[model samples]
Target: MAPNFSPDAVWAQCCEKLRAELPEQQYNTWIRPLPPADVQRDGDTTVLNVRVPNRFILDWIRTQYSTRLEAILASVSDGPVRLDISMAARPAMARPAAPSMMPPNAQGPHSLGTMGTALPPNALAARASGNYQGGINPLPPSAGPHTVVLSEQGEHPHNVVGLHGGQRRNGHPQVMGLNPGLTFDNLVPGRANQMARTAALHVAGAPGHMYNPLFIYGGVGLGKTHLMNAVGNALLADKPDARILYLHAEQFISDVVKNYQRKTFDELKAKYHSLDLLLIDDVQFFAGKDRTQEEFFNAFEALLAKKAHIIMTSDTYPKGLANIDERLTSRFDAGLTVAIEPPELEMRVAILIKKADQEGIAMPEDVAFFVAKNVRANVRELEGALRKVLAFARFSHKEITITLAREALKDLLSIQNRQISVENIQKTVADFYKIKVADMYSKKRPASIARPRQIAMYLAKELTQKSLPEIGELFGGRDHTTVLHAVRKIGGERAKDTELNQQLHVLEQTLKG
Candidate 1:
């Protein structure tokens, strides 16, 4: 309560508190690097301004530590205090040298030679040329019992050991956790995944040059994982020894936890930071796990500093994720973020036919169309329906036909029909946006109500077998032109607005359920 209270003293006390409460590595990585605060007074409010070296640290501190820092300031200060975090300016002449991408305990490249397959002679040149080869070094023979050997046919055992047990040959790890079967050649392209696939292909062709940390997101079974794997496979094909690893987000979390328990962060860094590319799936699972986020953040920074590419998939876009640190999410959004929408009708038909051909079954075009029309949720469902139809044809000793397809997919068709009525869509959309269902029919024009109503109209037209006039009639007798307008507006915006597209995806999934 002293009039001459020093903000520096308060900040010092806050740092001491954080140091005591947080793990040593976390405190050192995040808190100790922060510059001193510049505190001032304006209109009875004490403003504490903190500057960080970069946007990453600024976002990290603001999201993870700002509230606690503010509380500490308020507790120590006499009046209300506000926190303002910003990036510090870098002086051109005196800017600090970039930190080594190597881990703290690592001596040199030779330090890792004992752990896995030895690096090739041209490894440095390849890395500098953006053609880096090899993934994490395979564990020593004594480290594990299983040894995964990559086959020439691009097939590996289903129960292949994890990343570390892969075989070593010609001084390169043979298995980089990639499924060679999932490649760009086999992945059917469509408007739904066109943008995402293009970005992925760019990353594959020239890793770490553009779209660094490429992010792909969408609903379940919509080919997010397939796209990520395709990128890794493409890179591996170009440089057989390229260091690449593909894994789900939970696997990374497990690695973090295991290393944390063993106090072996150096090994963790050596494995992940040395890669040419990282393809991770479903990063939304990283939510709420502080230690994992911190470690992943470290790996992410190291890879980028070394110009290594990273591809991550999630059920939602970066900003749409929950319980994740702002710094990580911000980094996730730093690169190109694309969505794999549910396949369109033509694309779905194409997928069914292609997959059937791959199975050596001659799928009639009409049957493919019939299956595509009914199984509109995603490619996975489309594949499942194709399998059912194929099996029914084989067992019944008949040619593949629409009549057979209908009988095969009767249950799915019934479920689809039972769900997703216009009324159900209106109710779901209203509940999602926290508006009244009646607002869909009412003349309310506020954005909050109108947006959800328009979304409902669009879904009605897409999901139900309703024409424009019929949909309009269901929506409180609105004009067919209004219904068409809503559909067109939402359809156009859905392609451009990531947030709206995500919202619509959620509503569609809920209605389909």
Candidate 2:
């Protein structure tokens, strides 16, 4: 008989894979809260009935997250799994309630909590309509001591907050100077970006959000950078000159190091202190660097005191981040964290079309799908593949077709399979848990050694796409039973344990890494 896969089992695994492949925003909104309804086979293909609260949720999942859904489902079962999203009545099966109003994509203690004093002028202006219905925790209206009373006149339209005490459009705004376009309207909502998009929208209008410090993280090509930029651009429009300075965290560290080297700490402090909005990208780079962490801590403290809005981007969540100091971790935890994962196949196609539209390239749907399939996980790389396919078609005097996409992406397509090797998976799992390679295949039963080994087995099965028997042979002649235990054991643990869920996610990094 075919393997009987439970929806809960699939969902648990989905969370693990989605968190790894997607952002926290995507995870919570698209996958975390949502539960799988049923898994049934359709001829040679598998049909997955995934339920969402409403039509908007279904639509968003179909658009942004479908590719990832397919990839993940493909892994759990042998047959092709296609996602069918629907708005059904609440199921009889008990599921943890989904947070209707979660924290925005990149909110922090200031944005969500009682702390964070330097409120951006735009944020203040947004407070005019009291339209902040989003975020894990909405900022209570009781803040005071400002000479200018918060009111309608302070609210400026077109993403600009023309309040008495707020920053400029070019300036960052802690207030509601959100660019209207940056609202859910301008965002191309799809399965891939839906969760992140929803979380961001909530936070853009809401505050005191639990998804605070919205640590939107993902591979290089995913839209983590895009979503965060949209937040800044949108909010900046609301509060022009609200003191927004967004740069790579590496830049932040370099500046700190430079200041330390040149004795310009005071100047750097002054620059950061003046900001109403601060955005730092690739925060993981600050890991393992004590001085940078110390400086970041100070800057974060100063910003919190000022109530300036802060946003950040990274490849890993605050917890997964290794080598970072504890103080830094605590501060990071003080805010909401959102993650942006790779766009799914449909989203990739949408991205391709969006790019094509931007470039006036007429790409057929078939051609788009072909390109999307090969482009795989990295949103940027996927778009690049589309661009190349278009360019090659134009340059080679050929129409955009499935064949055309294949020939064009012959190089990029090959790149994905290169890293998904057995040895690579073993090493990746080992490196992720900091275990030795010998330990991976050794007979030792230490949970430390065995758990990571199972993770390796799971990864080898998933990433390399090798048969269970093949995977079993790869790990010291361990039979398929061992591989089965790894898959099932990790799946079971992931279902109940959030930490293990996160670790499994970290392991999926092998596919992309």
Candidate 3:
């Protein structure tokens, strides 16, 4: 008989290593709730058993923590240790039954407005009902179609699809590609992302029945993915058993290619069409991919027919998705489309503070403001600046302060402080058009001067936060309506006149530098 081992001691040591390695929120969500079930020795290998509450977590542990947990166990044990994770037996309890495919109360906190009934497809009837095998096993599409099953090539599985006992905790299932950490509760709302966040939360509460397909568009690092994941998590909170798929368009393309090579087209259909909710990021990648778009179109229609909610993110507006099939673009625009503008000053500071809090760092308000003010590009850059400040403080054994932040981000601040003034923009545009800078602020009605000035105005509107009146004042005391007209004119022509567009793009790039 193999000797018994202490599961409690083994798990405690594992937790210690994980707590040190992961962020506090990550540790708390994925590790802290785990219970040590049992331990046994199988020949030279020591096996430690830990129990999770549901299949969702069981797979999450295997996918995310299997190797790390094994190494941690080995480091703390007498010999090599492997983990065996499984779902615990549940006590009978009443679960919030899924509501009929009826319109959710628009006045409800999460619902947006009146939407017709649209439930998930027929495949949702099939659920995963078996013990987790320490490793991922490929199950039929009916059994949680979006569930990430390893392909023997070590690619990350896309999403975990379903629930057992209709219960999950903390965040959504890692379905499709949802990140557990980007919940709606943690997302800071501001003028930039208010509408987008509101629509997302509404979709989360009602799923397919409301906001049948929510389209969120924004520039890079502006929380498009974060909002989509928050919706997925919110849906998971309500319907723990929901089959959700959150994946990038590139991932979808890759999966399609793989299936094509393997001659598994039916499986691809099953995988995507089976979901109760689909959240695809960066659908702009579908541009020029005729075959991929065809497949997606079919799946899209299938999902819509079943009333499955779909959410997609793109870096540009649906109408601006050039080189993409018009049908797909029109379909994308058919739903609730929201734009996430760049965060304003106040929102940026709040984001920095929130990120600092998540990192367990005490960032003085002034320090946060310093970093936020300088890192004005996007949330990603703001977080990066904060990380640098935190790293410097930790290494120097000093507290975070404005002085420390300045010293830590000197180079970044220098680049950020190079303001793109209207004068600089006018000069760049004039030089590019071989016209005089004086033409910018002058009433020069000549086509050459007028066109250049209009382009500059359009660029100002797109790149700066200046009000139309402020911009008009800088452009020779013109009325705000004149500025608006110039902006609209240039914007309309930007798509049609490639040379004009290129000239404006180059001028904008030079001015930003």
Top candidate, metric TM-score: 1
Can you tell me which runs of candidate 3 are displaced by over 4 Å? 1-174, 415-424, 428-436, 440-513
If ranked by TM-score, best first, what sequence of candidates would result? Answer: 1, 3, 2
> Superposing all C-alpha atoms, what RMSD in Å does each candidate have to the true structure?
15.3, 16.0, 25.9
Tens-place lDDT per residue, model 2, 1-513, is 156756567667867887886545446545666765567767865566665543334444554555556566667754455556654454332332222222212333334332222233355324422333333223233332221111110011223334323544433333333333333333455644545665565444433232345556655756665566566665555645556565667667777889989998887777777666665667888878888888788887676654555667777666677999877766674454545545545667777777787688778888888776555546656666777887898899988888878788777556656767888878887887798998877899987798889888876765565899989888988989889988888766654443455466556644666
Q: Mind giving the per-residue lDDT tens digits that candidate 3 earns over 269-306? A: 87787778888888989888888999999898888877
In model 1, where do residues sit more than 4 Å from their true spots?
1-166, 169-174, 432-435, 441-474, 477-504
Per-prediction TM-score: 0.63, 0.53, 0.56
lDDT of 3 at 194: 59
Candidate 1 overall lDDT versus native:
0.70
Model 1 TM-score is: 0.63
Judging by lDDT, tell me the better candidate of 1 and 3: 1
Index of the highest-lDDT prediction: 1
Q: What is the lDDT of residue 263 in candidate 2?
A: 93
lDDT of predicted model 2? 0.60
